[model samples]
Target: MLWPTNYTKLASATMFTLFFAGATFAPKRMVNGENIQHFLQRHYCNAYKYLASRLRHLDAVIGFEVMNEPHNGFIGLKDLKAYHPTETLGPR
Candidate 1:
């Protein structure tokens, strides 16, 4: 009694879809836009600082350029203030 590969894949997909159905219909609030922005900023800042501190004098490691790349998920939560977090609506 072994399931086919496609069957397993479909089953997994269906299960996840079901689990995330609420998110599809409404905001999940899994991530906050401002929090995520700050989190990424802190992440890169710390990494660069740590490396720069250790290897500042090294010629190859003259400078570390930190990129501030942020992503807004499906709900488009970049600016949630106007829409605001509530029982129904979320930032878009």
Candidate 2:
């Protein structure tokens, strides 16, 4: 199915927010009969595998790094409602 560019962008953004920003990946949290943490980890591993397979032949591509600047993912936060600022990289 073909999707409009704007729709695709919105969908991507929504998924990122839901999966990365919002997901706590707690063992108790269940989605579709699987633990959220395990589900996310499985998808991450699958994505890495797909990328590795596609880039394996490329000599220029030495390695792949996923989530280089990893966030805590809302874990062990004292305040759930408080806004925590992320450190900015690069110049303005």
User: Whose TM-score is greatest here?
Assistant: 2
Assess the local accuracy of residue 37 in candidate 2 as a C-alpha lDDT between 0 and 100: 57
**Window of ten residues with lowest summed lDDT in model 1:** 83-92
Please list all clashing residue pairs in model 1, or write none if there are none.
none
Query: lDDT tens digits, residues 1-92, model 1?
Result: 23322222333433323333424533333335433334444565788788888897788766655532221222333444543222222112
Clashing pairs in 2: none
CA lDDT of each prediction against the hidden true structure:
0.41, 0.52
Query: What are the TM-scores, per candidate, against the unseen true structure?
Result: 0.33, 0.56
Residue-wise C-alpha lDDT for candidate 2, range 1-92, written one tens digit per residue: 33322222334433443455444444466679876556767788999999999999999999977864343333444654552232212111
Q: How close is candidate 1 to the true structure, as a TM-score?
A: 0.33
